[model samples]
Target: MIYKAEKFGEKYTTRWDNIDVDEILSSERLLGNYKKCLMDQGPCTPDGKELKKNLPDALKNDCSKCSEKQKINMHKVIDFFKDNKTEWWAELQKKYDPEGIYLKNHIANNRHGDKNDDKRDDDKKKEERDEMEKNDNKENSR
Candidate 1:
């Protein structure tokens, strides 16, 4: 699947099968920091150029700042995934359920081995959310 970036939202989606799980997981971790870039500072593209140019001050705010750390950390994480795709993919497959087929699939596919329990719990939450959305649609249609 192609990962498309949203206009205003920072979220993107790619095919689960096509994605290198380890890379995706790494990217997910980095995305949290990217989110910090947006929330604390302002919008930024993952491409790094924008963050480098527009938000230099925000980027250099402080090491103690999660956003600052995220900015720097994301670069290393992204670089590692790009350079070590095969190794990362292997690790991801070994640790995660690629054929998730559930709500938790979204989060689970991106987390390390120890987080499966949390993934299961997240799946439950997603199921509930889905059910609520369905019910809401039904009510609206009535």
Candidate 2:
């Protein structure tokens, strides 16, 4: 289930229905901080390098100051991401998920598996070459 930033202790660990978590997540400033922290520039890069590690959360804007509109912008975005499953919770990533919470296949968890898959092609090529060399040697001997 989606959660409010506060629920996980943006202030304290308590369930809050009055505060809109979506808005907090959707805040451009907050999202930008998330982008920098997660290094989620794009699906790929020319060099595929990561952004700097552990950008100070102090660099991100104070969520306590977020305006009402910023908060409202969050609702649809969170719902959209949850429904699509590609978008992710950069802010709420460490926030909280209650016990037995239902989960979805989001981009973050999926990316690690992708790196292993990228090696499959190289492995296949090496195997093919080894097989070809074996066949060539066998043919020459025959």
Candidate 3:
């Protein structure tokens, strides 16, 4: 069966029956083993050279047109994993694990933030927090 999870306006989909139980179990175990590594990671550095990688032409066409906050958030997420690769892998394992995962309310909540500005504000705060943490890491490393 196809299962979907939504979070922060993004949708994640998986097939329950088609996946391997052994793989899931192994991923969970690995994640548990690397929790500490994930927590200690730092932010990624800025790269403005323009990427023609990993994305389709349609999506990459106007990459530079993305908002400053969007760019920063993307970089921060990348940096976080790079700094804590093991932990990040573990967290991803947990996220993908079938038993503990909860489905996100994608249908009920729209991504546009048209229903309320609260979601926008919350996203902004999260971005700010990520940026602040990145800056703090840079300061500490100096």
Which numbered prediction scores highest in TM-score against the true structure? 2
Model 2, residue 136: C-alpha shift (Å): 0.4
Query: How do these models rank on TM-score, best leading?
Result: 2, 1, 3
**Could you tell which candidate, 1 or 2, scores higher by lDDT?**
1
Instruction: Say which candidate scores most in lDDT.
Output: 1
TM-score for every candidate vs. truth? Answer: 0.22, 0.25, 0.21
Candidate 1, residue 142: Cα displacement in angstroms equals 0.3
| Candidate 1 runs further than 4 Å off | 1-113
TM-score of 1: 0.22
Q: Worst ten-residue run, lDDT, model 2?
A: 50-59
Q: Residue by residue across 34-137, what tens digits does model 1's lDDT show?
A: 43443444455544334433332322332122233343343344344434554553443333324423223323333442264466679999999999999999
**For residues 31-66, could you state the per-residue lDDT of candidate 3 as single tens digits?**
333333323332211111112111122122222333
Question: What is the alpha-carbon lDDT of model 3 when measured against the actual structure?
Answer: 0.36
Task: Estimate every model's Cα lDDT from 0 to 1.
Answer: 0.41, 0.39, 0.36
Off by over 4 Å in 2: 1-110
lDDT at residue 86 of model 1 (Cα atoms):
48
